[model samples]
Target chain A: MSDAAAQVGLPPVTPEEDHKVSEGKGRAFLGIPVVGWMLIFFGVPYFLLFLQSLWEPTAFGVAHNWTLENYKLVFLGDTLSGNIYIPTLLRSLKVGAMVTICATLLAFPIAYLLAFKISNSRTRLMLYVLVIVPLWASYLLRAYAWKVILGQNGLLGSVLDQLGLENTFLNNLLYSQTAVVITMTHIFTPFMILTIYAVLERLPPSLIEASKDLGVGRMKTFLTLVVPLSLPGVIAGATFTMGLSSGDFVAPQLVGGKNDVMIANQVYSQFGATNNWPLGSAIAFVLLGFVAILVALSTQAEKREQL
Target chain B: MINAESGLTGAPTAGAPAGHAAAVELDNVTKRYGDVMAVEDLDLRVEDGQFLTLLGPSGCGKTTTLRLIGGFEAPNRGEIRIAGDDMSSRPAYKRPVNTVFQQYALFPHLSVSQNVGYGLRHAGVSRSDTAQRVAAMMELMQIPDVGERRPRELSGGQQQRVALARALVMEPKVLLLDEPLGALDYKLRKEMQFELKRIHREVGVTFIYVTHDQEEAMTMSDRIVVMSNGHIEQDASPAEIFDRPLTAFVADFIGDTNIVHGTVTRIDNGHATVDVGPLGEIGGSTDDDLKSGDRVRVSIRPTDVRVEAGAAGEAVVQDSVLVGGHIAMKIASGDETVVAHVARGSSYEPGANVHLHVDSDRIRVFAAAEGA
Candidate 1:
């Protein structure tokens, strides 16, 4: 109990009581603006999209008559195109997983070096800025820059041609699924590095030394001790990339081939050329559902490890 | 002047038998951080199963020497041998030695048993055997019920024991502890000191402990190496360190004492007569190759100086400080002052004349050296 509480002849506030008071009075009302903002900007639009998905699309405009025809077309497949929605959504997931794996693999070493290996603060600061400076450039420009490099006569091809290795490196290098993965991995790596670096920076250095002192070799110590301790950060970084890349439309549009189109591309086409807002909103919500489930699972896993 | 090698005495413990093999040896080791020399031309040896302590103030190079032995830091010019094998080029991971860090660096993510069994897992011990040994080690540390608890959930004392258990479970040939009790409160520090000494006796490993606490060193160490300014000032048993300090620095650092400045008037067989300006002539033991007219300081433990009330004495009682079991009174004669530790409840008021008697056999005379 606090001295003030004792002097006032009142009981000290327990955590449960404090929580109850916060939930009971003006403090609870403080959340009104944030909840209202989310509802007006997000909740109402999502509800309207759900309603629109049930309405039928007429030639001139959306009909007021409610039906499941749009959902049926999305699930059973378009009459002419067989099962493109499932395959496209699955491809998006695969791309998100691939990008997340590659980014995390490439980020751990850089984060470890930044946090522990570099002894000088000034040098570490310079390297930190180097990692983040790429994010300062326009994302569209960076994506386009990769497009130029991966194209047939771009940097890799021209360099290979100059070396007389003409057709060796050209096949499927440009406008392919691999191209999308590569570009997205490059763009998402800094986020992973920063997250992992933040965790590593706070880790006590003596813990590593203690492991080594107890007859554990360097490599084993890293695998057993360092990796498990840093798993939360790795999960956090993977969550960011997974959430962002699964719904990404820009990278695939600029660098992907015909068969490499993701679900976001289909949704974009429905809203633009097809003028089918109902179908587009349905696809968007489905993708959002998958990403939301993954994020929740990862965060829950992180919390479990905290104990 | 005080010299490094002259103050060293033989190991006084009964555990180290004659011809006992050295578990660790450092020959003229030197370590430098940039241009600053953290340890300089240091040579030391530890007997197998001996509990040795490095006692010094902060920045006294004691920690650097421990690191040198643990292979955490390589010496610029030296040869280190562990169990008669040269370990100068070996890294910390390959060396058969372990260290309990100052912060008790237990793995926060692992349970107490997992932390204790970590090194065993690396060695490919069977799961059952690992569990058995971890349980036994935890039992030895008196923390049998904390195996499933994470380090963050344990008390400071429990965490320290867990760290000890973690390192000892590896069964290393030597254990290095860097101020392991420094983070605990006074009462806990004292308790852990006894706990560490018990563990040392039970395990019979060569334990190299470091601390700046003189009382801790005196209580727990079989031998203590006192360091100052990147050099070994005195290396001997704690009793000798307190009773027969070879230099003024050793005497002043180890415990409370009254130092009276004087110069050697004559030397007779191992005993020297010195003339203190205000207290007149006094005779004490000397070992600094003293000659006539050589400046020196006579060190007397406060308990050795007897105070008697008198009106025609050379000294007068200045004040009496009440320490629980004893009263430490200051006696001033002209410009010289000396403290006498008397029994509690002695009522010697200020301004009372007191005749001071010096225990000549217990007094230590060292040459007054500059920058010691």
Candidate 2:
């Protein structure tokens, strides 16, 4: 609509047409390397994994003959074990749900305080650095550190003993599902806080003022205004936490007790100790299916809120 | 020459309706954010249904004063009352005042109807009653068709109307608008001005508008409070403000006027004869407290200016624009400048030689201001 460009003898392009021009023809070569890399490294592997899920596993090793027996085992369960595949996968989901809820509960308050309450920019930045600082170290180290802290002779039990509280209860903290949940929650909370804070930071202050101006009280305003506005961020964070935690094997291996075996650990053992790649790939698809549905539903919810 | 136009001849509008009270009052209220004193010991009273505008440049505390009234910000000192009730300790939601923010902060996630109905929900109104009120308010704003659209989908002007509708739907005791038309194009702003005035009349709610646009202030306000450096310089009708500014800041800010520094040489009643340095002696008028020996500044409106290609003057015609009904000329020499609104037929080239002339009696002298 501006005449300046036309007056300057330049062709005026609508934003839509301009985007098309940038994306089409000669510019297509610009994305070739990244696209080619994704197809080679990502696309080919996932395609091969899909094929591996359908192949036969003989007594010696994986054979060329294709069969649906591995998929049947994924549904029918391993007769040698007490339905461990389906049960472990379901347990993984429950843990993922637990980690997601706990993480979001802890993250929202921190995000809100940072975005709205802390007016000092330097202070907020310092706190944000503190939150993400742990991500710099190895993820395994953090998970392993939790095992040490939660152990009977370690930090928690020793602290309890120092405080003269019951120390025996601390022994139950490590090497359990609770340990897995607690460690994963601690590890995943920063991502949730970052995502929620990004959206909450962009919330226009005027909107809150306007809501209050209209006679909506502070709590009501937060529920009706702040919560809805931050839903996309919450959904995004929840999706990541759910997807990663449900498929996670490392935390379960390091912190999980004998009964806390998860689907990802089984997926690993099928390839390593068991030497049954076909069953592992088939089991992996079940996890993929659940995570895929969660992601797609969250994305739809996010898109529905957009203008 | 003018001094309060003698009696401020721009007769004040009819006093508030009988039995009507002030809808909002700020008594010696001061608001400070960190080191900046945004509003200082300010007292203001907006009468019921009065269209009062706080007109000033940015950082003049006009918007801050509006926010205090709307309870968006509590004062650092002093009390604010709405409908004769003290509102000092109350938060924005507890007060009976609403604000249409300068940016028109409509709820982007909600549809137009939902946005309008949001505040009503807290009123504990029935669903049908909320619906009826929301529909009526939307109809009043002329935005009924956009009920299902989100805030971003609407045009700027439409969003402004929706904001107004959302606030007014609450039937708050006072409505504060922080330059509601600031983001609109000039043509749309002019149109929205009339729309706003019409809405104000129909609703009969007190409107406290804030804007730095003097023309907008002049065209819309029943009373305009001119502010400078967080203090009020003048609070009067638009005509009085335009004709009889009390300070050099007010005169300079309100119109296209040339301020010429001078010293009073003689006084007759409230009128004075001043020595305008290079411009020589000129007869003008000012407040009686400005004694004959006091330094002064005189204001000459552009309409009072006349230029012709005759004797050599201090300034040459710098530029001229044909502004519909008149030719606006910028004439300058050294640090001194003058703007003259000439007849439509008058034409002057950028570098044309000219002499500026003004009727000596038409200049208005003001007492010199301090560092403020």
Candidate 3:
């Protein structure tokens, strides 16, 4: 046999066929599990949600009628015009953006401390436990605690009343967007800290020392080396905070007023009070789409940062 | 010309020869971590453009000494000076020195060119100048193609070269290399030793290298400062250190040495006749100050002792080993065993009572009390 034929274990003229066989098997090995899981969970649920959004609500439970009316009703602002759906959606996006920024900013210093400042393993572990312990508590309980703290007759009001500043505090602080943001930030801050901490921990200490040895100051080292290297964590934390805050219905419901209602609360309202299941499903899908877009953008940003 | 300063107290003048300027001076430098003293009373000087290696085993404060010089840690006492200027209060960034760490410590996230350009960028050099300097450094290190590759993407040797380039591009007066070739394999490390020596010469910067490997220290350094227990045991050229170690620690550390304990029986001229327990009276040069009855350890390098067939003289061969480049034989006189090395093709068998002759000039005598 010729060298080419022997090398490929095929006749010279049939190389393309051999290549196809190997490529097909290789792709099949990689694609089967991912495609199977996606079809079973994500693909099926999304398909059902699409069907639900198209179905019209009738006197007998819900009925299937392929129409754009439900989507039109959501967009037109004529159905429950004065209600909180559109405003809540906008508020949720704003809250998500705010939480993302806050979490990222707060996480950087804590992560830097854990990764570089604390050298002893036991001390680092203890600090890590302290940061993570809040996460073990019930999310609802934490949100409820925030409500108590911000309520008119609660912690803030009591403190302000003692200081003779109760009037100003009550008017601005309780049941507001600010209150919702503060609560969400508390709940999600650990997630951001832990994610960023993990990435920072893997960073080689030598790089920082090398930076210093090269006559780069501490602040410059953080800007040039620490921040750029730990960006994946920042992106991950941002995506997580955005996803959680935008989809969160409970925290805002407890601490937020009618004006503070987010898109999740709107979806809940559409499903429960209005009994508009199709509109609710459409709104939920829209939120999912929005999150998917954000996730994609963040992933693209991460890749660009890597380059 | 040598600085004509009178005593040790006199400051080494500024216009002293390039090799006598004391580019780096550590006077009574000490470092303590809690109760443990990592470095104790380290007094060292690196003349301008000298390649000085801090040689020691692990945890011997060689790395700590490098850190002190780099201004990474403050000494508990004394002071550090770079070119006669005190730098005790200066942080690592402000010091005019850079270290190439053992692991190369190349920034994994950055391309080679970016890492090399980092110091220049921090120095506020123009972007174009930084790029030009980085390219020049890459060319100097002979790794121009590796500039675009991330550290992990390159081989061990490639990463090493990039690290050297990165530190050298800064044009620091002193370059501290903390076991820089420790991560490379034997052959590669040997190659890098030569490359580093060449680079040090070409750059004309004082290179303070740290390594536990004695062979590497011997090959690359203009002078080797042998350290043990955070104290300088002996500081000399590799040849002097190997051929004339002042302490048993330096004798044992530098290379293979057969140390036989003996007591001086007689003193004549510069030669001392020693009576080793099993070995009969042997005469070796007394390079140290010793009394007639002073106990001493006689250090003989394997290469200096000669083995012969049958009893040509008064030595008895106990065992013979044929290592590739040379034949190593263990010879004994009574109860004392001495290791001897012969040329590769020598046919010598164990149990043959052979004569052992040593080059008297190559043997070193040290006080047994100083053995570590």
Candidate 4:
């Protein structure tokens, strides 16, 4: 054969045909199991929940009735008993926003330090391990730990008492919105750090040097070059933090007061003490929808930034 | 003309103006990385509008020297001056110099035009002026149409041009290029070398280029500073370096040459007669004073050695490599092998005995102890 054909090594074939054949068989082999797994674990439950949300809460359990009362009770009720959904969701969203902002602000410098400032690989790995060590502990245990730290007679309260500020600490230190926000920020900050660090680590050092050589100062370089490039990770981190913290039931339950209850706590009460699966499913779907919208918006923003 | 204090001093060339402040000067600059010295006490003066190249092998401190001038690095013991201003403590951004980094380092996020206009924007140039200058630089680089494309979308050569445009558009007092064309393929590298030279001439900015490729340095640099082991081995014009390398390291580094070791038998005026064991006695010019029994090395270019049909001093033809336009024949003279470039059509078979003649005037002798 000719040199061209020899270099190509095989007879010419249409790529689309080859792709179709490989995808038809190979996709079924690999993709079918994953698809089946997702459907079994995620799809079936989610569909059931959606169906349940359309029914009504009965004396014993839920009844098979097509009604919008659950949603109406969720969105339109006036009092806390009539409609705790709006207040709880609004509080959850506020907490999520605060957690996201605080976590991102706290994580950025830490990620920058790990990725760029600390050049020694062992030291960087140690620091990264330090961030991940807290994650290895049980999530519920961590939430409870936050409860002990922020409790009436716990570490913070005793410290405040020693400092002669017992009155201020006794009134609002434990079972407050600040306690929940603080705990949520602390727990979720590592995820943001890891994500942003991953992106920043891949950035070539020469780009920063080039920016400096071009007469841009350190702050400008960070703003114009480093931050823009690390944005996808930032958005991903925000989405993850927002998604996790807003839907979290434990942190709010352990450290939060009645005024600071999140939507997840309401969902839990509906499923447990209230015996209202349909209303619980509706609240869960609302939280899921909100998180989904947030994730979609963030991913879209990240895509636009890339372009 | 060359001195220990001044390193290697060549007479001011046409491109270098008389009695002007050196575009970039390094005085007693020493950069140490922990225990190892990256650049030892070195003195260098790059004249305005002159393309001075730091040409060396890996770990030879060429890139380190470029980084020093660009203010990416500060000397541990000495001073760096740019355009008569002492820049010893100034960071890279504060210094009035820019660098075309190795592998381009073009901003992947920015378009070609934005990347090129980066410095202009930082310099407080208005949008209209930034655009005009960016367009002008792109046109000069012959990449006017690639302004809208991202750096990753461009080919290597195009990326290189964009890098050049970026650095040059800044209108800095000096441009530090750190192996800027090192990433391009051979053909594109050759093309970029000419482009760089043309741009240097057109812009007349002091360009300090770093490269390990000797041919690239010779082709593009007005002057080449050959470095080895964190010190300058030789600094001179490309022709002067090629013709009369100050040390054996420079002779070997610049091109293929026969480094014949010999001991001086006599010194007549400025020339010395040295006994090269296998090649017999050869007369060559020396820069250092030589005694009757001083050891020296003599460098002979391959093209200067003549191989004739008649056998006077017997040499066995070991190999004949048919390079285009000429044949590089390696002949064994006694125990030592001497390479000669003969006309391509010459029919000399391996194992044939051929007579070798050295062009006495073209031989350069250096003190044997000065060899790297």
Q: Local distance difference test, per candidate?
A: 0.87, 0.86, 0.83, 0.87
Tell me the tens digit of each residue's lDDT in model 2 across B1-372: 112122332233223234534576677888899999999888776666778899999999998998888887889998887887888778888888888998999998999888999888778988899999999999999988888888898899999999999999998878889999999999999999999889988998888999999999988887899987778788888888888777778888997888877788998887888887655577776753777778887899989988888445566888999888999999875456778999987758888887767775556888776632
Q: How close to the true structure is residue B91 of candidate 1, measured as C-alpha lDDT?
A: 90
Tens digit of lDDT per residue, candidate 1, span B243-305? 888778888899988888998999988798998886778889877888899998888888988
| Superposed model 1: Cα runs more than 4 Å off | A1-82, B1-20, B258-283, B291-295, B305-324, B327-341, B347-361
Residues A146-244 of candidate 4 have per-residue lDDT tens digits of 888877788778888888884564558678889898899999999999999999999999999999999999999999999999999999999999999
lDDT of 3 at B239: 83
Interface RMSD of each: 1.0, 0.9, 1.6, 1.3
Per-residue CA lDDT of candidate 3, range B219-281, in tens? 988788899888888888788887777688888889999889899988877677787765556
User: Of the candidates numbered 2 and 4, which has the greater DockQ value?
Assistant: 2
Clashes of each: 0, 1, 1, 0
Models sorted by TM-score, best on top? 2, 4, 3, 1
TM-score of 2: 0.90
lDDT of 4 by residue, B227-324 (tens): 99899888798999998888888888989898878899989987889998867788888788778888888899898888877564578888998887
lDDT of 1: 0.87
Poorly placed runs, candidate 4 (over 4 Å): A1-40, A47-57, A62-83, A120-122, A166-170, B1-20, B293-295, B310-313, B370-372
Candidate 1 CAPRI level: medium
Clashing pairs in 3: B278-B335
